[model samples]
Each structure stands twice: as structure tokens, then as C-alpha cells.
Target: MVPPAVESPNPQLTQQFLSSALSQRGPSALPYSEDTKWLIRHHLLSLTTSFPSLEPKTATFTHNDGRSVNLLQSDGTVPMPYQGVTYNIPVVIWLMESYPRHPPCVYVNPTRDMVIKRPHSHVNPSGLVSLPYLHNWIYPSSNLVDLVRALSLTFAADPPLFSQRRAPRTPPSHNPNPNPSPNFDSFSSGSSNPGAFSSGYSRPSIPPNNYPPSPYASGSGRVQPSPTTTTSHHGEDQSEVFKRNAINKLVEIVHGDVVGLRKTREGEMEGLFSVQGVLKQREDQLNKGLKGMRDEMEGLEQQLQMVLMNSDVIEGWLRDNQGKKFRSLENVEDAFECVDVLSKQMLDCTASDLAIEDTLYALDKAVQVGSVPFDQYLRSVRALSREQFFHRAMVAKVRAAQLQAQVANMASRNQHYAV
Candidate 1:
């Protein structure tokens, strides 16, 4: 097609284009509004000057394993190995463009064969992969070099291992159960190194002459000398004797203070222990008393149950003994009728006895009236008969005699006449 031939990419132009592209994003990128030519020039200057100057050099760092590791920032990525762990390395600088404004990206590029248990881990708990001490770059209008240097030092120190490790927070106290576990923090032995022992550094040692008097010795107004005394052999070199005497007095005073402190502590501990023991004894007694009361209540309840059962039994027996038979009206009527019949029979017997007595009395009265004047009555009858008979005889005799007498009288008359 006889078209114009395409020109090859210019080294400068290619570099410029790549720089412009790289500088468009990120905090360390060049100004976004800059002209292409200026952008190219800016990127060119950064490549030729800034990048080589900024990168950390190869330095030997000692690891926890007693092994020395060579560290450096290289093209692509440099894998930092620590404690059988590998961390992805970040680019130190980009040659094409982006100045201080565009910090480079990092990747995990392992040159040596390694095992990564997890990816995208972090030193801080937030899991943010960050440049240490570079919080200022995160903000605007700050020195980026210092930030980079701090990041460099953090990397050199290999703080990921330690920063990831944290001491556990204090645990919550156990309650209700009241059996408190021992305080682990109080019992744990701390490392002896000053750096490890406390956040504050140890104070520098003072010389013997510079040492302050002991707090205990201060009350006695003197400082004690060491056993290795610095003095002449004289019993009393005035100054030396005075120093010794003052030291002895201070020692005595310190000893006395210690003795007092010990006594005070002992008394306080004894009082606490006694109070605890007394409270325990009172609690035990209260529990025992409650138990005794419960036992007594149970016993009383049992007795009450037995009494109720007995009452029920007795009631059942009484009901059975005094049952319907005894309560029947027919039986009661029969008993009353029997009593009336017996009363009537007794009355009849009494009437019969009274009638017998009257009959006997009548019989006795008839017998008394019918009884005779026996002999007098008999004599009267006999005499009446005899008197009649005798009267007849006398009449006859008189008649006879009269007849005779008449005869005689006649005779006698005759005789009398004769007389």
C-alpha cells in the first residue's frame, strides 16, 4: 500500500509516556494536570536522580535463629524471610516516572522455595499492610523523606514478628462461686532485662559518695557506710569516729523501723484472719441451727400424721360398734314394749295378792261368827226337854194324888169330921 513507515518508539518518549501513566495515581504520583512535556521531563528527572538515592541498600540483618540475612530492595520484588515465614516485598522506587508523590506497589515474589500459611497478613491487629511511621504522608504537606526513612528503619528492624505478638489483657474475675483463681499477672515472673521489665528505662547508678542516705537512716540524721569501711585504724580519729557512730545510730534506727513495720503488718494480718474465722464459725452455727429446726419440723409433721391416722382408725371402729343395728327404732320399740308388759304383769300379781288377803280376812270373820257357846247351848236344849217331861209327870202325879187326896180328904173329911 505504499503507506508512510511507522517510526520506532523513542527511548525518551517511551520513558515519558510510561512515567506519565505511572504518575497519574497514588499518593507519590506527579501532578495530574501537568503538560505531557513537563510530565515527561519531571519523570525523566526522577528516574535519572531521585530513585537511586532513595532506595535502602543491601545490609546484613541478624534473625532470631542466630542466622544473618542479606536484605535489599530489587526490581520485581524481594521476599523477606523470617522464622520460616515469608513476607511480600514492596518496590523501593520506580524508574519510569512517579516522584515522591507516588509510592510503588509491593508483591510477594519468592526467589527461594517457601511455604506461606496465609496471605496479606499484617503487623498491626487491623491487618493493614502499612509503611511504619509514614502516617504523615497519609496526611498532606509533610516531609515524605522522614516518613520513608522511618518505614525503612521499621523494615530493617523486622518488627512484623514482634509487633504482631501482644501480651494478653487481664482476665475477668470469677464470681458467685467465690473461689477466686490465683492472679496470673501477680504471679508471673518478669524478664530481668530493664527494657523487658518496664516501659521506663533503669536509672543510671550513682557513685558511693553520691548515694543518698537511706530513707530509714534519714530519720536518725546519718548515712551508713559499707562493711568495707574506708577509715584509719585509730579508735577515734574524731571525724572517723563521728562517722562510725552516726552510721551505727542510723543502723539501729533503721532496724527499729523495720521491727515496727513487721509488727504492724503481723497485727493487721492476725486481725483479718480472726475476723474471717469468726464469720465462718457463725455461718456454720447458723446452718446447724437451721438444720436442727428443719429436723424438728419434720418430726412434728410425722407425729401429726400418725395422730391423724389413729383418729381415723378410732372413728371407724366407733362407727362400726355403734352401727345401724343399735340405732334401729324397731329394736328400741321392742325394748319399751317388753318393759310395759313386765310392769303390767307385776301390777296383776300385786292385785292378786291383795284379793287373796281380802278373801282370807272374810273367811276368818265367818269362822269367828259361826263358832258356838257349846255346853251352855247344849244344856239349855236338854233342860227344856226335861222340863216339859217333868211338867207332864207332875200333872199326872198331881191328878193322881188329887184323886187320891180327894178320896182321902173325903175320907179325911170324914175322918176330920171324925176328928
Candidate 2:
């Protein structure tokens, strides 16, 4: 027994869906691995959100041939430019299973007419790889609609960040001899010569110095800087990028350390002043004690001499009158106590002198080390500031380019309808 007849799948319908998905909304979200869809979808969504004015509408056109063509599903139609001239914009977003880990192939339309600026071309637009500004295209957790919107907006807006060219520089003329001070706009490098720089900008060599200057003490010649190397506004020959980075780093480091030292210095001053005051008091006390001890010692010597003389006289009397010998013994004991008091005063003075010297030494050491800590900390902070500055500039450039493109597209479209 044979089985009943079954209907066959319509090839035209399949083609239409595939074409619509590719041209209108980009690749199917279902066919793609979850990771691929998420990554691509997020980038597209962010691009669209940036421009609220534009909306996408679908249309279909079938040719005289039996083959029915849908703008999105069939061979994609070139979008009509704002001037009503047809500009072919063919973009394809396809994914591999190893995406994010491996970048997807993103075909940008209108490649022949599309002139992207330098530097930005180095980036991968998919945002899966670590390209400089590619991450701007992506957002977190997106859908297919999001990706289509991003692509549409991205094409509509041609931001200068993505276009790095500076007025499409012309190469130097090959017919003329290379000379110093070549004009940036018009220069001759002989017809056969390639551009000096990759961007085709003319960088002239330094002219020979007609007037020789005297040598300095270091025996270095007074060489004038080449105009080609020097910045137009500044005599410095450093690249703008390097200069910016250095400046940023320095500012950051200096500001941080200055603030820290201000706080630290206040605390340190209080302790130092207190220690200084104690030291001064000890010095004054030692001086006063020494003076008093000297006076007492001299008086004791004089008194002893008087006593000795008296004793001699009294001895003669004692022989005659025994009363004076007992009085002499008491006088000798009083003189010994006075000497003991003078010895203790001398020991105290020496101890005070040692304490003051130790304190002074410690304070000097602290001052020496504390002087440079703030400066060192400042230098470190400056380094960080420089890094931050560069990152900010890079991000800003990409954003600016994106905005420029969007504006340009809008203007073109508005002009188209005006006609």
C-alpha cells in the first residue's frame, strides 16, 4: 500500500523569508547560536536608540520575470539617497558558532563609495573583538530588531570618529624636487614619489641654516627645530598623544599629593611644635640649675676656708678651754651636707642636657623624610591622570564621529524631499 500525497514546501516563500531577514532585519535570530544573537542584537539596539527620528518601513516589488522579488528577501534594493540618487548600501551580518570568542563576518554595504576615516577602519564593527570604539555599537541583552536598527542608524549617521581623514589630503607633486617648507595643501615631491606619511599629507624637510650660530658651553650646536616635526602652534616636537598623556598624569599626581600633604603637614606641625617647646623648657632649666650650683659651690669653699682658720684659732683656745671641740664637730657635719646637695644638682643638669639633644636629633630626622613624601605621591597621581585623559579623548572621538554621520545623513534626506 502507498502512502497519501503530501504538499511540498514553497521555494518562493522560503526565499522571501531569508531575503527579508537578511536585507530588512539582518540574519535570523533563531538560526544563530544564542550568544551570537545576543552580541549582535545589543550593538544594533544602541545605534538605533541614539537616533529617535528615523523609522524603518518594509515594501515589496516583483519584476516582469516570474521570479518575485522582495526588497529585503530577494536581491536587496539599494536605498534611495536623500538626493533621490540610488546609493547601494549592502550590509550583511552573519555569525559562526565560535562567535564572541571568534568575531563574526560583518559585511558593510556601499564599500566602493563609502570612505571611512583612518584609525577607525582598524576596528571590527561587530563589537565582539577588542577594537577601540567597537563596543559603542553594542549593549547588553539585545534582539534581532535591535541589530537592524543599529545598522540603519549607523549607515545614516557618518560620525567623524569612524571617518579619520582630514579633508582628504593630496600627495606632493612628483614633478618637483623635495624642498623644505612644503605647503600642506599643495606640494611637489616629483610625480613618481609616494606620500611621506600614510595619509598623503606633505611633511617638508628642514631647510639648511644659512647663518651658523655659536656653540654653547656644552659644545652643542644651536640647531633650529624642523617645522615639519614641530607642532604648528608650539615649538615642541612631541606627538599630541604623548604630550596629552604626560600632562594628564602630572596634574593627577600633583593634585592628589598636594591635598594629602596639606592634611599631613598640619598634624606633623602640631607634634613638632609640642616637642620643640618641651626641648626649650629643658634647656632653660638646665642653664638655671648650672648657674645656681656654681654659686653654691663657691660659697661652700669660702665657708670651709673660714671654718678651717677658726678651727686653728679655736684649737689653741680648746687647750685652754675644752668647750670649742664639740662645736667644731657639728660645723663639719653641716659643711658635708652642703657638698652632697651640690653633687645631686650637677647630675640633674647633665641628664637634662642629654634629653634635649636626643629630642633635637629625632625632630631633624622626621623633617628630612617628611619633606618629599607628598611630592612622590603627587608624581604617581599625575601618571594616572594622564592615562585617564587619553581614554576619555579616544571615547569622545568615536562618539563625535558617530554623531557627525547621523547629522549628515539627515541633512541629505531632508534635501532629497525638498527637491
Candidate 3:
């Protein structure tokens, strides 16, 4: 099955545009790819949105020769000034089979007479408009809507009919030379002309291309177009595009500033958080130290309390028993007489006990050392002990008296307790 030759975005006008396109474009029109069809539909849709005067429809016309062709174009009316006069001009953008790879072609279809000459740099007598941007087109980066906007700006600068050519500059004449050397032609052979030798070589003539400076060229051969002629091929340049680029750059700068400010604030917050953490740690350590010190202080206080209690008890004991007196009965002289007798008896008893213990120890030692027989030594010790025992009994009676006198003296003094 043969695919439809024309794809109309606006289905209502499809039949009418099909007839028109068949008549205008040839029978050999190529079938559009899916992408090309989509771009055309999109271009038409955008034209309608931007230019209310657009008649968005696809058209094809079948000629009498039994041939059908498709014209891929979207027509619109745009307000423009020509020769200092404003008029809404009818325009059309045609998409070829090789679109996207090839730039879209434009035509300024005037409603008026065909013979009327319009002074436009890019729009010639045939109504073909050449755009510099289209000449420098790169697909995906360049869109139909942008192309339309560029058209708008191109019209805003000196539009087609208003831009006229200035007078052509005439070349300066260097024809008549009064002092012509006849032998100048002979200068081709350096040694042939004597007159050519007398006169130095004549200055070289300047080329016509160099004499008349091309509008695009300066002293340097670089093609530098004026700002007004940036789109001279399309009769005007796009100042709006430059302005838009500048605005976008400014927005980027502001965004960068905002990002920098956020980073600075985050850094400051981080610093503050670190400081707070350090301070909290220090506080915890100080509190722990304070708790330990308080515990130590409490222990010291308890020790002091115990010491004070002990001291108080000692002081009370001293206060109660430091000085005291005892009341006793009579018979003091008798007690003194008894004490002297008893003391003399105690001294005699102690001496007898010592002599008995010494004799026993000496006899035991002599027997142990083999100086005497064990039986003889024992008999000698027994005799001495019996004599000592008699003396000890007498001494015991004297000691009992002496103890009684000591008790009397202690009662009189009364050092620790009251009597």
C-alpha cells in the first residue's frame, strides 16, 4: 500500500492543502519519514500558536497529467516595516524531503503585484529569502520555533522593502601619465633598455578587488559583518537572541551565588556544632570531677566527727577523775608501825626465795655437766631448800603486814576514784 503523500496537522484543512500542494510541488515529491512528518506537524502547530494569522494545513494537488505532489509548507502573516512603513506580510516556510539535514526554505509571498520591486538584501526578485542562521544550521540545536523568532527579529531590523543599496563606489582613474618613459615596456629584459636603467622601476598598479573594499572586509581580509547586517542574507539581524543569551548568563551567576551562600552557612553550622560537642564533653568531665571531690569531702567530715567524739570522751574522763579526796578512819600510827615491820619481813622472804631457787639451779647444772653424781647433787639441793622453807614462812608473816600498810596509803591518796 502507498503511504499518504501529505501529512496534515490540522485534519480539517487537509483536503484543501493537498490540492494546493499537488499543483505547486512536482509529482516526484519524496515520502516524508516519521521524524520529518513530526517536525512539520510541530512546526505548523507552533506557527499557529505564535502567529494567529497562520493557516495551518497540508495540501496536495493532482494535475491533469495524472500526477500528484505534496508541498510541505505552513503559511502565516507577520507584522513588519518596509521603507519606513508597517505592513503585515504573508510568509511561508517549506520543508524539503532532506529536512533537518537541509535547512528549511522561506518565501515572502506578497499579496500585491508581482512587478513591484522591493528593496531587500536577502529577498531577491524570485522571492527566495536566504538566512545566515539557516546557512549555519545545526540540527537538534536549531528548532522551527527559534527559526520563527529569528525571522521576527530579522524583520525588526531594517526589513526587506526598506533596505536599499547605497551608490556603487567608482574606481579612481590613473590613466594619463605626463612623464611616460618609452623604454618602460623594455624593462621586461633588464639589460635591453638604457632609458629603463636611467629611470627606476614604476610603482605596481593596484588590483580592482583591492581598490574597491568589499562591505564585509576591512584592511584585514576578514569578513566582519556589521551588527545590523548579522543576518544580511535575510535582510536583518537578531538582536533579541544576543539579549536572551546575556539574560541566561546573568541567571547562572545568581544561581552560583546562592549555592556559595548555602555552602558558607553549612560550614558555619558545622563549626558551631563541633564547638558545642566539645563544650558538652568538657562539662561532663567537670561534673564527674566535682562529684568525686564531694565524695572525698564527705569521707573527711566523717573522720573528723569520729575523732571529735573520741576526744570528747577522753576530756570527760579527765574532768570527772582529775582531782579527788578520800575520807578515812583513825589508827594512822599503828598502820605506820605495821608497814615498817612488814616491809622488813617482805625483803627477807624475797632474799630467801632467791637463794633457794639459785641452789636448785646450781645443783641441776652440776649433775647435768657430770661434775657430781645425780643423787648426791639432789640431796645437797634438798637440804638447802628445807632451810630456806623455814625462813620463807617467817617472811610470809611480815609481807602480809606490809600489804595492809600499802592498802592504807592508797586509801589516803585516792588518785582515780572518790572514797
Best prediction by TM-score: 3
The better-scoring model by lDDT among 1 and 3 is 3
Instruction: Predict model 3's lDDT versus the native.
Output: 0.55
Q: Over 4 Å off in model 2, which ranges? A: 1-250, 262-270, 320-419
lDDT of 1 at 3: 12
lDDT of 1 at 100: 30
Residue 81 in candidate 2 has what lDDT?
20
lDDT of 1 by residue, 211-269 (tens): 22221121223333322222112233578446645654665566568679999999999
Q: Output the TM-score of candidate 2.
A: 0.20
Q: lDDT of each model, Cα atoms only?
A: 0.40, 0.40, 0.55
lDDT of 2 at 291: 100
Q: Candidate 2 overall Cα lDDT vs. reference? A: 0.40
Per-model TM-score on C-alpha atoms:
0.19, 0.20, 0.30
Count of backbone clashes, every candidate in sequence: 7, 32, 9
Tens-digit lDDT track of model 3 for 191-276: 33435534534322445222212211123343322222122224323684566455446655665686799899999999999999
List the pairs of residues colliding in candidate 1. 27-101, 28-101, 28-102, 29-101, 29-102, 415-418, 416-419
Q: Find the number of clashing residue pairs for candidate 3.
A: 9
Give the lDDT ranking, best first: 3, 1, 2
Worst 10 residues of 3 by lDDT: 161-170
